[model samples]
Target: AYDGGSPTRSSQMRLDIVILDINDHAPVFNQSRYQALISESLLPGASVLQVYATDADQGPNGDVRYEINRRQSDPEGYFTINAQSGLIQINKPLDYETRKVHELVVQAKDGAEQPEVGTAFVSIQVRDSNDNQPSMTIIFLSEDGAPRVSEGANPGQYVARISVSDP
Candidate 1:
């Protein structure tokens, strides 16, 4: 059985090798939907929340980078993401009266070439911020010439009317 006998009784030699996994896995978010509450008056660079994702692939395939998916629905550019850290930060001030809740689509991509992408929804509720100051105006009844308050002005008599408004 010198040949075509599967090397029996010859100096039988076999080698064992491990085939590593390829970079075929996509990044997966810890949660399908993430909720966060942030003050509307936060600074532009303020950190809102940190997003986390994991990949089953090994080596560079497991490394993830984050990004905000901007589209027609997301007209307001009020958020930014740190690619390396997956940290979401405020890009601008939020107005509760104008828009209360903001929905952002975040994508996580592996470091591999032609990396696979994963999407996650991050709902950010803009909390009320006491950043507005009330504006008021006081109007005193004036005569034809001007307002002249006498020293004996009656307390019950109407002196002035105040109006308040806020923007």
Candidate 2:
């Protein structure tokens, strides 16, 4: 029997492969600071300011999610955000007495697991508007010159104390 041996001559094989980049880390914000102002006179629900961010990765890996991180100090959520759009809008009225400036931190995350996180600071300055009227604590002085006045005081009389609060 005759046997044919293999590999007597050298041969070559060709192959093609592509490797995609992994989005291990997300894009981070360079500056995590911001400030803004909205006059109390402005109509309620008015768009005050907008915040923006950037992503370093490509494709869906670069897609980011935006959200507002509320602190314990902020019982009331005074701001809103558009996740896809990265827009921040005011959600409540501001009272100077209660809060003159609002401090907030915005977070951005990429699609990757344990995605990279970025932060931004926002300071909102509230201006005074005629909308807030001051009311006196005392309703009115008695005609008999009595220190204590009875209930049902006149409109102009000192009825209650008025204060302003902002968020």
Candidate 3:
């Protein structure tokens, strides 16, 4: 290390050089965007996906904490984050029929005082689950609009209409 731009000539005099870390660099995510698909039948508190980031700063200044921007990004309140781990987890059940896509912003901030921050976008696609039971409606009638059955009836003698729907 040079003191005042001039190196002090010393051998056994013992000159200690220390480099300090400053919060000059902001945390940066490895990727600008991350996407994943999850089933709508997934329960709450399940881990869906994760995002990673890095900071050039040293020591505590490089340590990052993750968070979700609820007001502007996660308005539906469907997700959570591990502050120190950068893991994004689910907070509630998902419904693909009502809504298919969820967009949220993830923020990474350093542990330094007046910490530098960074952000990334996350897109979660909810896949429809075959959990809904089909609803069926049946109507039976004769050609003359009267219900009549015969043991010796010919083929195509009965008229029945069945309709089914599911979500």
Which numbered prediction scores highest in TM-score against the true structure?
Answer: 3
- Which candidate number maximizes lDDT? 3
| Residue 103 lDDT (model 3) | 93
For model 2, residues 1-167, the per-residue Cα lDDT tens digits are: 22346635555667788777578666676567777787765655677666666787776678888888776224487778788766777677667667778787788888776577778887888876666555544423456544654577666676344454432
Candidate 2 CA-lDDT value:
0.69
Runs in model 1 deviating more than 4 A are: 1-8, 14-16, 72-76, 137-163
Worst 10 residues of 1 by lDDT: 1-10
lDDT of 3 by residue, 1-167 (tens): 33454456434457699999999999999999999999998898899888999999999999988999887787778998898887888898888988899999999999898999899999999999998889998776766755667678889875777789997
RMSD of each: 4.2, 8.6, 5.5
In terms of lDDT, which candidate is stronger, 1 or 3? Answer: 3
The global C-alpha lDDT for each of the candidates, from Candidate 1 onward, is 0.85, 0.69, 0.87
TM-score of each: 0.72, 0.67, 0.77
Off by over 4 Å in 3: 1-13, 138-161
The sequence of per-residue lDDT tens digits that candidate 1 reaches over residues 129-149 is 777898998787656535567
What's the residue-level lDDT of 116 in candidate 3? 96
Candidate 3 TM-score versus the reference: 0.77
Name model 2 segments beyond 4 Å from true: 1-15, 71-75, 135-167
